[model samples]
Target: MSGGAMLSLDGVHAVYGRKIRALRGVSLEVRAGEVVALIGNNGAGKTTLMKTIAGLLAPEKGRVTFQGRALSGLPPHEVMRMGLSLVPEGRRIFPRLTVMENLEMGAYSRAHGAELAREYEHVFTLFPVLGRRRAQLGGTLSGGEQQMLAMGRALMAAPKLLMLDEPSMGLAPVVVDKIFEIIARINQEGVTVLLVEQNARRALKAAARAYVLETGEIVSAGDSASLLRDPAVQKAYLGL
Candidate 1:
C-alpha cells in the first residue's frame, strides 16, 4: 500500500531566499506502476518540484506526503531510503569511480553480500552497457552511456517511486528513444514514475496522466491521452 500512490505534493509553495518564488501552491501525485509526467517550459519550476519531492528543498507551504506519511523536514537520504529516488537533469556520476562503483554508491545504504549481488545483477540487466563497462571509470563513458549509468545507479536503490527530470535533454533522437524504452520497461515492472520532461510529445505518450506547469503553477492536468490531444496543450507544448 505504501509503495503505490507513492508520492503526493499538495498546495506546495517554495521560495528562494525569501524574495523569489519558485513554486506557487503546486500539487501533483504518482501512483503505482504508472508514469506521470509534469510538462513545462524553462523556468517553470520543474526542477524545484523534483528537489522538493526528493527532500533536497522543503516547500515553504503545503504538504509533501509519500505513502500517507508527511515528508516535510525529511532529508534527501532519508527519502531515498524510503524508496524514492531521483535521476536528475544532468547525469551526476562520480567520474573517478568505476561504473560498478557508481552503482554500488547508489546502494550504499543497504548494499550487502547477497543483496548487492542481486542489485548488481538487476541494474546490469536493465542497462547492459553498465555491465559491459563495469570496470571503466564513470567519467570516461560517453554521454548516452553516462545517462544509462545514472539511471542504472538510481535503479540500484530499489526505489518504489522514481523521479526523472529532463530525461531527453541534449540526447540524440536514437538515444532518447532508448531511454524512453527503458523507462517504459521500468514502469512495466511496477515502479511508479514521476517524469519531468520538456519533450512534451514523448513524455505525454509515455505517461498515463500529465500536468502542464507554467511560471511555477499547473495550467493543465489530465489523462495523458487527453492532454496529448488537447488543443491548448497541443498549441502551447506540442507545436501541433
Candidate 2:
C-alpha cells in the first residue's frame, strides 16, 4: 500500500504463549488526522492488532511503520515518545494516584514538562470533569469518568496518532455518546485516531474509514458511510 500512511502495518504476525496465533499477516493503516475504526466480534484479534501497533506486543513476523519509521522492537514507552499512544482496553489508571498524577505519568516521556502542562490545560478543556476532580484518586472515579481520565492521560502524551481499544466497552449509552463526541472533537483538533470499539453503530458513525475483522483477517474495508449501508455490516452490526 501507500508508504505515506500515518501508521502502517505490513504482514504482521504475532503469537501468544508460543502456541496460539493472535494475528496472522495482518496489515492496516490510519492516516494523519483521520479516525479509523476496527470492528469485530469477540476473539477477532482486534485488541491484539492494536497492541502490536502500540508496541505493547511485538510481531513474531512482519513490521509496523509509523510515519515511515520502523517500530518492530521499540518498547511501549519508546513508542509513546514517538507520538503514538494507546488508551488500552480498560482504563488502566493507578488506584493510589490522583487524577492529576496519572496525567503527569502520560507526560513523563516528554522532556518538556512545562509544555505538557500546557497540553494538560487543553485536556481539561476537553474533559472539564477531569479538571473538576483532579484531586480525586483515579480509582474513586466512576466508569465514565475513568474513561475520560484515560483519554485525558493519552492526550497528555501529545500523540499524532491515538489508538483506543474498546473504549466504550461497558459504559452507559449516554456516557458512550459523550466519549464518542470527545473523540470526534479530538480528531477535529488534528490528532489522528485508530479506534477499536464493540459498539459498531457508534464506531462506524464516528470513523472516517473502517475495517471489519473476522478472526485475524480483514473481511471488508471502506468508508464509514458505505460500511453503514453495507448489507453484511448492517446484518452483523447495525441491526438493520
Candidate 3:
C-alpha cells in the first residue's frame, strides 16, 4: 500500500432534517491500496458515513478530501469522476435491467469504445456467473448473484477507491465467504477499499486497519489484529 491518504474525513459532522446528528466530529483516513473496515452496530451511522463520503450527503461541518482535492461541494457524479466509487448497502441493483445493462449503467461516464468493452470483460472475469447471466434481468438472479452484479457494476467504473457498505449482509455464510474472497482479490488488484460491515469478525479479518464507530463517534481505532484482541471490542463486537 502507498503511504498516502487516498481519502480523508476531518472532523466531519452531519445531520438529518434539522437536529438529528448522525456523525459527530468523525475523522478517519484510508490509505492507498489498503482495505480499511468501519464496524459498528445498526443506527451507528455507518451508512450515513458512506453516503457522506460518496457526496450523497454533504457534511454540515468539516472537510472531505480525496486524491488531495477538496470534495465538500462536489456532486456525486463529480466524485465518481475523481476515481471514487461507492457500492452502497442493500445491494441496490436495478431489478428491471439485464445484468449487462446494469453493468453498462456503471460505465456511463466512460466512452463507448474499446476501453468500455475491456471493462465489461474485466467485470465478467471477476464474476464469471455475471457473464453467464448477462442477458438475464437482475431481479431474476439469486440474492448472492445480485450482490455480485452490484459489485461488478461498480467495478465497471474502474475506480481507484471502492467503498462497500454491508456487502455481506443478508447472505448465507458460504456466500459471504465468497464475497470476502472477491473483496480481497479486488484489493490485490490495486483498488483501495473502505468497508463498512456489521459482521465484526469477518470485517476485522478482511481489513488491514479498522475503526470501531459507536453512537456517531469513533470509539476505537487500530490494526485489525489489535482490535480483535481488545477485550472491550471482543465483548461487544466479536462475541468472544
Tens-digit per-residue lDDT, 1-240, candidate 3: 244888999999998567889999999999999999999999899999999998999999999999899998788999998999999898899999999999999998887889888889888888999999999999999989999999999998899999999999999999999999999999999999999999999999999999999988999999999999999999999888
The superposed Cα distance between candidate 3 and the true structure at residue 197, in angstroms, equals 0.4
Compose the digit string of candidate 2's lDDT tens values, residues 11-101: 9998856687988888888888899999999888998898888888889999999988999889988888899999999879887999999
* Estimated TM-score for each candidate: 0.95, 0.96, 0.97
Query: In model 3, what is the error at residue 81, expressed in angstroms?
Result: 1.1
Alpha-carbon runs more than 4 Å astray in model 1: 1-4
Q: How accurate locally is residue 105 in candidate 3, as Cα lDDT from 0 to 100?
A: 92
* Overall lDDT per candidate, in order of appearance: 0.89, 0.90, 0.93
Tens digits of per-residue lDDT, candidate 1, 16-109, equal: 5567798999887787778999999998999999998889888899999988889887999998898999999898889999998998899888
Poorest stretch of ten by lDDT in candidate 3: 1-10
Which structure is stronger by TM-score: 1 or 3? 3
Clashes of 1: 0
On the 0 to 100 scale, the lDDT of residue 52 in model 2 is 84
